[model samples]
Target chain A: MNIPKITFIKMNKKEYILIAGLLILGLLSYFFMYNIEPGAMVKIEVSQKLYGTYALNKDQEILVKDSKGVILCTSEIKDGSIRVKSSTCTDKICIKEGEISSSGQTIICLPNQVVITVINEKEQIDGVLK
Target chain B: MNVKKLTLIIISSIIFLSLIYFYMNRNIVVAQTQFIMNTTIEIKLFGKNIDKQKLVKTMNRAFDIMKEVEDKSTSYVEYEGNAASLNKHRGEYYMVNQDLIEQLSTSIPFYKLTSGEFNIGLYRTVNIWKNATDKNYLPSREEALNSIGNSTPDDIIVDKFNNRVKLPEDMEIDLGGVSKGYALDKVIVFLKNSNIDIALINAGGNIITLGTPVDRDYFNIAIQDPQSINKILGTVKLNNGQAIATSGSYSRYYEINGEKYSHILSGNSGYPKHLYKSVTVITNKGIISDILSTSLFLLSIENGRKLIEKLDYPVEFLYILNDDTIIKSEGFKIEYSQDNLYKDE
Candidate 1:
């Protein structure tokens, strides 16, 4: 009985270098896409539109305005957390919600149609039950 | 073939295969948020083979389902075949949408289970309180008591065959307690039918998971502290087909004359009971979780346990008492955050 033998192909030094380079490129891209450093940015959306994203490290007051240039609310980012300092809405529930420092935490002012969410690249929690 | 040519071919094929592998294994997540049912409704879809556009379209369809439920169940606005219309034609058999009939019929049994604590027939009482809150004054005790009509869910005549319903005289129905959960259930059905797995729908505070996450065994859901707005009480792990719903008095309330009144009004007393600051329930069904959370929040701790024992569906509960005491079921696993203030009971 005759048996078939499998033959393997051997690569030269240049080919090996090319393969290694390609593998490194793939690994780098993978890490670049997935292993993002947790950022401290808070995204403010007004009426379902992306109003702006502000860094949490900055201690500044953001005056969220409407389309007609009317200031709806004032949000303060202090000590790596943000809170609604004041608002023109009636409920004032947004002001009472207090400060949110963690990723995925949100302070929603329904009366003014504004939602401020802490946006981190690596979110600690998928969703929050309020 | 020459050795050099064979090496070049092998390297090219290796790179090609890796590219295909990466493309096929790409995990795409699409999330969108819309304000519906008086709160934000966020739909998140997770899949390997679907594109972002398709996922977003599916999410819009899911939001449409929720909007349909809101249109049918909202008492604030009167639609053709919604709760408002039914309330308008009380004491007579009014033809309505089949979805409303199904929702009412499904919720009626809970009225008996909770002993009228979970009543949908408190719209009039709700309106009175809402009006009082808007006017910045408290309603008179007599006025609030008179608004609490004696109509029970038993008096609701649901003619399934005709797709119509009749409410007892002076009984107004508000499906606020179950509408969000009902919408979640409907959206889940639609998502499953679309052959998309591993999704999460959060209608305000009520969250439902379709399948386990791609990178994790279960979805990590953080329960907000009722005492403090920024702090979390703990984190709970929810597996596939499980939902968590919370009814917290601290989230929604009206302050009138230096007094706070929660929106969660008791069908029996026509007043909000501060048995617990927040009651969270985990169950297999979204509607059940929603209904049980609200019902259990209104009941005492002892009575709430009794109600849980009587239910056939598997459920886990966590109660945050007014004094910052946390009580959880034995099977519910929660990882307390560092610096957790609540004392475990």
Candidate 2:
């Protein structure tokens, strides 16, 4: 039996360079791209049991609640907007409806005890009316 | 040869390790540029802290939504005849836009409840204000009153079964006053769902707040002196989830002969009133706050007080009178700081 000759497969110079370059670039990009996204939430609490509803477009409803998870207000989403649809509160005022789609727009619950609003990861507020 | 191989390997390894380190920190080094469309409105928000970037984005979106409504609203003039166009011949019915039909039907109830004070069917009158080209100037008394008669909210016929609207001969409907508020409300919802912490969306001075200020003792919002917008009468402290809107003669008025005509004209008189120089309402509902702000400014103080008592939605009002005195409800708090450079009545 003739012993088969074993030969080393030498890597080509260009190929070696290419592989090294790609690995370095990929690793660098991957590490650099990994990031921590900022996140924050603002919680609006109410002292009274205010009945309210928030509607997106006077159609879709998002219910607002208290810390105990009791329903305080409902919201409706419409026309890419949200507003208070109905409330057990005397005014049915929130029911007169408003629109809020961004974190800044807010509706409060007066009777059932909740304040529903939007905020961000940083508690930094930008402007005041004064 | 061995030394060269070792040097090459060492260089490669060093390069590889450095690349890994660079990659790991890439996010921190590269600043992501974003295009944020921005618009600003001066409005009073109750009990919320707002972030600047979030507020700018919301305002931009709010303007975009306004354009959307203008395009889709049935009351909108179809520069091009399309599905959303309103036709008068259907006895108050026309092949209307689904969106417009729905919004009108929903807000129409408010018009009825407010006895047309909150009517969206003031298109004819609003057009008079809008159509005023620079050379055209504001309409003469006769012209202002001419087209206004046709705008009776009762006459705005919407055939629910057909989902259409029929306007009277000379009347039109305009949601300009409320649309911004409506847009502000939607942006609020968007921010909440995204779990943003604080923000303010102001569209041409329509203020909506996202959260209470972390630094403020309270959301210290100023109520502008209607007579002199640059001068503020006082500030209100808000803690959470409240919206404040001000309807003042100063916001939109045609100055002629030193007499100011408020943008909020009486649909009845075809003329603006000087009942109250400005009215600010604080509430959860932006639309209600916007409308009531105007209504209260136009209505008698007695009626205004009665309205607040009826609603009692934490609406602290500030009325700047023609006489230069301020009228605030009993529970209404107007915080005046010595630094706040304005005199309170």
Candidate 3:
């Protein structure tokens, strides 16, 4: 049987400092990058334009109108979740899409050309990969 | 080492790591939304080294293709290349566009596949219901039954060589269910040809995806509850190149005397099927998924399973009953929330 000798090189002072600095830098970046301040607001867009941003904490009913001032849909925010109450669009698919409370969730009414999305500081992923 | 030398080395190291971090985050997504085909068309492109202007141009072209498909297939659009022309020139070989020819040809096979339950030729029946719904009334059974004529696959003749089509007399075609899927397929092909690797196209209940997200293995799709519009039934993770279509009675229905009449009618009775609250089908093709969703909604679980089992590929399905007992196919790997009562049947 052949015996192999293992060598252990002690880390130098500069190497230790560099490793500590890199670890701290990584931790700092991660803390800043992933510290998701839970979304406090819901943004509504109609016809590809920004409609309005409403606070999630507030309970209110918003009448989403089109460019011609025609009331397209009514959105209600209650208990931190927002849902479409009614819509003038024939299908009313938006109303059936249900309520969305989590960040990065979206409710889209195709017929009315409306999109309701929840946004927070940490939520940047557009959609889940399929 | 000297203090000045140590500080300079640390600064240089920080700069090098910053460059690496920036390089690692180079991948970005460019998304655009447009209104076309009676719905919002949103196209997203995920890539690192992408031509922004070229991708936008491709997206515009994709929208134009959707508009073209809508024009060629929709009975509502009264254009030169519209499918309504086939109805107008019924019993005669009317010159039609290639798009209409493709749309009709692709959908005609499904009429047989779904046992006529998902018929596109019932435009008259749909019109009667629409008129009645608009007036807030229910259409009579006799009126609905009389409207069904020459609404089968055999009645619609496709003269492929001459680029013409002939429909039976007094018959009108409605591509309401399949048009969105057809348009989605067209847009997806255009995107693929444009070298777009990852994209998602949603036309209301008809959704089609091309590739996986840059960091995810699958896309998360939530199915909403029909009884309660404020809740979701479950979440389905869709694989790459998969399509899902949902058919439900919750929308596009009229209430009369506390009873609901949905828009999806059955060829057997010419009345909307009231069995399931919603049916969602996941398959390889959008048109197949769309037709199957409607067909399954009108069918019993045993019959629906038999129909799907005969197909070449395995299709996953989720059916939510009126009583909220969820029934899913064996292959359907969906995660339901705590509120749902579900089992893989």
DockQ of predictions, in order shown = 0.25, 0.11, 0.04
Runs with alpha carbons beyond 4 Å of true place in candidate 3: A1-130, B1-25, B255-258, B341-345
User: Which residue segments of model 1 deviate by more than 4 Å?
Assistant: A1-123, B1-25
Best by lDDT: 1
List model 3 lDDT by residue over B109-175, tens digit each.
Answer: 7677767776778888888887886787777788887888645766789999999898888678888
lDDT of 2 by residue, B33-151 (tens): 12212234433222123344554555455445545645664344563322225533424456765556555564665555455556565666666765663335666767767766654
Q: How close is candidate 3 to the true structure, as a TM-score?
A: 0.70
Candidate 2 versus truth, CA RMSD in Å, comes to 20.9
For model 2 the local lDDT of residue B7 reads 98
The model with the greatest TM-score is: 1
- The lDDT values for all models are 0.86, 0.58, 0.77
Give the Cα error of residue A93 in candidate 1, in Å.
50
Looking at model 2, residue B187 earns an lDDT score of 57
DockQ score for candidate 2: 0.11
Q: What TM-score, over all chains together, does every model reach? A: 0.74, 0.55, 0.70
Candidate 1, residues A58-104: lDDT per residue as tens digits? 99999999988999999999998999999999999999999987656
